[model samples]
Target: MIQTFAFYLFAVFTIASGAITIMARNPVHSVLWLILAFFNAAGLMVLVGAEFIAMLLVIVYVGAVAVLFLFVVMMLDIDFAELRAGFIKNFPLGMALALVLLAELVLGIGAYRAGALELGVPDGTAMAPVGESNIEAIGALMYGRYLFLFEAAGIILLVAMVGAIVLTHRPRTDVRGQNIAKQIARRPDEATVNVKPEIGKGVSL
Candidate 1:
């Protein structure tokens, strides 16, 4: 009843936002629509009893990724016309991919309705108690069963962040840089000259 209504509401918003995310002419608006889609998708996950995943979608995708995307899009001096110049050339490929995805989605839904997938099956005694919070249950599962996978995902994200930084980093040739190796290898004799002067005589430059 209420859950079904909520599910439909989230589904409709998710679909609409996703469409707008692709079709929006403005890149900033596209990102905002993407965030909206992520939020509604998270809501759908919550309705499906996957609250941990829902929170993660909000925290990671909405909080970090979407905001980062918005900031980057705003900061970059991109020419919208140049960016859209290839749309006509790529339209056929995009349409083909969209059709393929639509067919796959329809097949997936049909299979799900026909019970072709053995989803939501409990795995014996490892299930969490009904009264336990989703976060607690997810933490238990992540630490107990999927600790290595979780750590691997963290490592992957760290590597990706490092890669992004490296890709965007540019060294300036105008600025003088310290040569530490040369400094370390230099001898006192090479860096300085000892001088002796007679009484009342000043050193010449």
Candidate 2:
């Protein structure tokens, strides 16, 4: 009974937050709404016996993605009023797309309920050992079966990071930059001069 109530609570909050994420006029408020939706979605996952995925959703989406999104939105200098001025002009097209998506969602849900697709296909992988946690099971599958794919994903992300750095890194020619090679090559004799000055007199360089 408690599980059912919690499920409904999470579901309602998730849907409401999602709607507000789209409808909020302020982008920062939209991001906050998005974070709320993510949190409730994680609660739903926890209720469904997917605690591992729930924790991942909170850690990754809420901790990293949502915070990054909020920072980016706050930092950007955009004329949102000007951007929103065309909302009326685009409303018809946006409504048409929304209707199309709604129709597709309804059709998919109906098909799923009607058992239009066969779901249980057995792949030759060992089931989780008795008394082993779901997290351990998932780890086994990821490290044992999908290790190469996981490594490839890491490589792809690394490449993307390098690409972003290369694209955004601009060298400034307006100011002088430190020359490490020149500094390293300098000898004490070249950098300094032994000077003898008359007593109580200033020395000229």
Candidate 3:
């Protein structure tokens, strides 16, 4: 009964949070909603006996989102005064939400430790040995059966990262760059032109 309730709770929250993430206009708010959605999805994964995948989802995706959130916040031309004011205003609500998520995580871990959740048994052909853990089984499968595919994926990601760096660092000859030495050596007279223009007429370039 408890398991059923928890599953529904996680599922509902995951869907709702995902929707909000898509709809949110503020990038920071969208990232927060995405983090919430990942938390709920992780809970759901735990209930389904895929705790390893859940951990990866949180660690990889949430961690990435946190970095993204930081960059987005830093790059934006935000009003710091308004931001501080909003933070003060929303601090209590944020705390409450954090507490609720923490409580849910605690309860989920407790339930799993107690072996109360059914966590349905695998019915596949590649069941693990009696003493082996699910993680061990997964590792074996990944290393033994899917090693080539995994390596390919790594190579693909490496190529993509290199491509991104190359694109961003490409040289441009048309644009004029700054000359620090020239600026330092320049006389004040060279920096300004005392032009006297006639009334109702523009000065020569």
User: Which portions of model 2 show Cα errors greater than 4 Å?
Assistant: 109-116, 120-126, 181-205
Estimate TM-scores for all models. Answer: 0.70, 0.79, 0.57
Model 2 lDDT per residue over 128-162, tens place: 87898889988998898999999999999999999
Q: Which residue pairs does candidate 1 place in steric collision?
A: none
> How do the candidates rank by TM-score, highest first?
2, 1, 3
Best by TM-score: 2
Model 3: worst 10 consecutive residues (lDDT sum): 22-31
lDDT of 1 by residue, 157-196 (tens): 9999999999999999999999999999999999988789
Quality of model 2 by C-alpha lDDT? 0.93
lDDT of each: 0.93, 0.93, 0.88
lDDT score, residue 22, model 3? Answer: 66
